[model samples]
Target: MGAATTVAQNMSLCDKYTTALLKDNNATNQYTLMILLVNTAVIGNYTTTPAPKNAVPGILANGTFDGKAVNLLPYFDGSLLSSNRGGSSGVSVNFLDGGGAEPLKKNLPANDKNSHQYTLLTHLYEFFGVLLQCSEYNKNPAFPAYAGHDMESAHRFMDLSPSEVGYFIQQVGLSAASFGVSQEDVTAVGNSLNKLFGYRCSPPTVVVPEQGETLNSICQNEMCPLDEKARCDLYPNNGTVVEPARVNGTGNSTGNGTGMGMPNATASGTPGFSGAANRMGEGVISLLGALAFVVAL
Candidate 1:
């Protein structure tokens, strides 16, 4: 699609999204946080962020995607995140640097501090603007397009597993839905993001789930779910396989709602990593599978 057309489309979608949300009685809650975060952008704004591991934000539904260990709330210092900004909306992110205590901070420079974060939030504000198909984003080339990080590259070093990424994306939709975006609009937004994330799910290791391994996996298996296909992929089909004793527990026992309550579909609307001609080794692979499937899910 043409850039102009894409932006136009997104704007229309956001209009629908915002209009619906405005009509919702429960829209004032945290589910509106993401919408408020991005839609609040003016021509210039401060930005950068994440979801923390511990106390998962109540706005985000609990995720059960297979590999998710850490929640993705941006680091918070005491009351910063919880501080009631009330009804004022200007894009200013005051998230504190989590330092060594948070895993997402691993990729950031301790010295860079707020600078990098500011850039990130700026980009995200604009990216969502872009995601919303806001033409204002195109007003300047130096904005996100000129100086912004692609999702995977921006987050690759953050120690984010595919599931963590998936959780973040899943939450975006569910939260929006919780705030009252129509299911159709929510589904549309989710679909577009899934495609966006799939395209960006490259660099480092990009492995597609084979006919047997794929649980309708997209972005290779970057966010593959552990259902029949993933389960079979992780273990032998034979029931005789002996599982190892649980010596330690995984910190990723994150329990919220199921990840990607929405399914990430291929271009053909079939399950698994899209594409029709690429069948043979991939025959609509799994019965069903999902990862919050990011915008990266």
Candidate 2:
């Protein structure tokens, strides 16, 4: 948390997140858009290969929303990592959103630069996209189009239940603390993540559980090589078994499409809910920071 906090705080004025972080275009907010990009790149999210390149600048240049460009490339390049971490060689991130929501929500057109949510989601999507690409998940037989990293894998592992997803969010908090990421930034990310999970992306997603099948079984079943490597790397000697989701009738439950569904609502409005979305988001940032530390290792 300390290292990450420093990075967030020390980010230059031009590097902060577009809104709050940049007050009067001079005041520096801890969590800036550039911080997200820097963290994403540190975790090896940006692609340097390919003809046109999916590097930060190109992606922002090509992607737009609400008639405005989402370009933050000037603030981030392969050089940012070298300046901050003293090295430029990137590495594959070992962590992933257990619920698989990151991959699912990443491609939503609504999340494009047009929506207010774009700034936050961009980090989420790019971080996960890069993770998927650099990891074995990109190579899974289920997603052959990504063989050359041209296309992102579209497999859904609706393996996590609402409660489990919440737990993942909590993990982000712990991870962030360990890495010295600021609590304020973590809270902001938490709020954003909460909104993200319950965001109800356009063209609702429906997941049909395999009778008695649970999220844990799916996450644990025929695990991809990338996931296996990640689990080992992240958990190491600690026998930290991933938990399963409990779908009783409490907490922010992502409905199963049929009848057990609910719109994306906050914990205040909804009963038995604990705002797991924000937790998940904060954890993601923390995990990214942690991964960046790993890369530095």
Instruction: Name the best candidate (by lDDT).
Output: 1
Q: Residue 61 deviation, candidate 2, in Å?
A: 41
lDDT of each: 0.30, 0.26
Predicted candidate 2, C-alpha RMSD: 21.8
- Quote the lDDT for 297 in model 2: 11
Over 4 Å off, model 2: 1-159, 199-297
Model 2 TM-score (2 dp): 0.25
lDDT of 1 by residue, 212-261 (tens): 12112233332333222222232222111121111133222233322312
Which regions in candidate 1 have their CA more than 4 angstroms from the true location? Answer: 1-11, 18-69, 73-95, 98-114, 140-146, 199-297
Estimate the TM-score of every prediction: 0.40, 0.25
